[model samples]
Target: MFSPQPQYNSPHNQGVVDGIISGCKSFCLQTSIHGFNHIAAPKRHWIERLLWLVAVATAVWGVVDISLGQWQRYRENPTVVTLEKDFRTWHYTMPAVTACVQNRTNQDKLQNAIKSRWNVTPESHPTKYLYYRRFVDVVTSSDLYHLEGYEEFANDPDLNVDLFELVVELMPEQRVKLSTAEQITTPPKWTPVMTEVGACYTVNSLAITDVALV
Candidate 1:
């Protein structure tokens, strides 16, 4: 992020600055002297004295300003540079963090509400809500997948009501332990129905509240 022209701390570097000023002064003096060559006699002391005085004044002003602590403030205060860096960072870095934190906040709020309503902690699990949102966004993207068939049944409240009935039926057996030491489980066969159901489950788990539609 280099600026086209120098601005901060100092306007110009010493090398080009002093050299150009000196060169200009020399050229002016030479031109003046050459002009006077045409004159039989001319008073040149006044012009030389004025130029020397102006140059000295400029040098003294620079020294005084540098001594007074104006230069270092710009040096020490990176806020201006940081402001630039932040502008760039926001353009590139902030959206992902924002989405993640937002999802986490919503998840926490939802979990708390569920606990308060149930008088018990709902099943404790780590759910990446942002990921679920991304998956849902992908599935719903019309250009990517029409997904129209899924959406027809996806919004059904009666389906959720029926599923909740199964949960209600199993509530009595909730306390029982199903794990047995010798048994192992393999992934279920990936049928089309299973894929749709799994996607729905993932989407639902991460949602702050279930949307019921018919």
Candidate 2:
């Protein structure tokens, strides 16, 4: 008669099994996903664990269903292009155009404005003139990214320059005419608007509050 075989459930084997179970429990507790902890808890009843399993399955199914529906829709209608024969007769609105002048500021006008406002010329008050010039450069320069340092000048009403007036005073005198369908039409009025780089002018702008018959 052969001796009884040694038991397969050795201490080392049992320890490895326990370690796996402990790792799974720790993962369930620390994970951000909901319902996993309830399923893994040792004190939870069988019925409660079953309910959590069903809930998690339902949520996963919902996400998968929505993904499939979107994919089907894309496959059905990938893209559509329609061409019109009489496209010339169709009415089309003119596109708005914004223009920024190369010469953003006029030195002569700035000097005059500063002298008129403070009653002091650059020659007499060199410090004050330099301060104003620095403010203007910070506001008008396109390369300067951070404006936090210039908050004082930006917030001060006394230092603020009339950007629109400065740009208009130096604007070159010119006439604009529009022609459409071999007929002369009046061009859209240029509206003054302040932008990141100082005063800019826009034509056929919807931002204008007062609607005009063009």
Candidate 3:
């Protein structure tokens, strides 16, 4: 008689059992989606974001300031020619010279010498001679001095007007790029013309035509 009535779960018990099963399933699903020990990705705090922004801004400002400072320094000190009598301010070792240009007379002498040696006389070819003198001054002046700063003496009104004119004229043409005096080798066709005097004389003779492109 006692066993005849099979034990039956009450509504509350059945509901509890169902709830346990549902809970277990939910737990399993959550574990599968996020590993049992997985750590959530941390969110960036507002303070951290603000600090990063500040750091980036500071770095950018520093770079801009440094760039502007360098530009200003370059402008203040420029890279132009300097007419120095003792010219010891070379980037490389230079040979000791017996004399340095003191006045316009030195340039005149040089011009006359170039005319005599190269036969580029002002009377014969005035235009050629003009360009020839310009090239000579540019090469000689830059070769003998520093090129990254303007010397105070270069700004004098009476100082080397011809030299200044030559540099200014050639700046637009991009022909004043050479920093040192280089001896140009004679071409095979012109080698015989220089045999009588020397290669040096030959190079000087052809320099006018080469530089002037005339």
Best by TM-score: 2
Top-down lDDT ranking: 2, 3, 1
Better of 2 and 3 by TM-score: 2
Q: What order do you get sorting by TM-score, best first?
A: 2, 3, 1
Could you estimate the TM-score for every candidate?
0.16, 0.43, 0.20
Instruction: Per model, state how many residue pairs clash.
Output: 0, 0, 0
Model 1 poorest 10 in a row by lDDT: 93-102
TM-score of 1: 0.16
Local lDDT at 109 for model 3: 61
lDDT of 1 by residue, 50-90 (tens): 66557656776788988667557668885774565544333
- Model 3 Cα lDDT, one tens digit per residue, 1-214: 4667688869999999999967755664465443321222136576665665566567768989999987887777665313323355434432321112212124446655555445787888998777666555543445333443335344544333354333322322111112244332432121111121111112224433542311
- Which segments of candidate 3 are over 4 A away from where they belong? 1-105, 143-214
Name model 1 segments beyond 4 Å from true.
Answer: 1-44, 63-70, 79-214
Looking at model 2, report the run of 10 residues with the lowest lDDT sum: 170-179
For residues 1-214, could you state the per-residue lDDT of candidate 2 as single tens digits?
8899886768998899999989978987788898778878788899998998899789889999999987887677655213324566766667676666655556657677567656667899899888876665555543235566476576677765564454455443324444455342665677655555445566777765442211
- The lDDT values for all models are 0.37, 0.65, 0.44
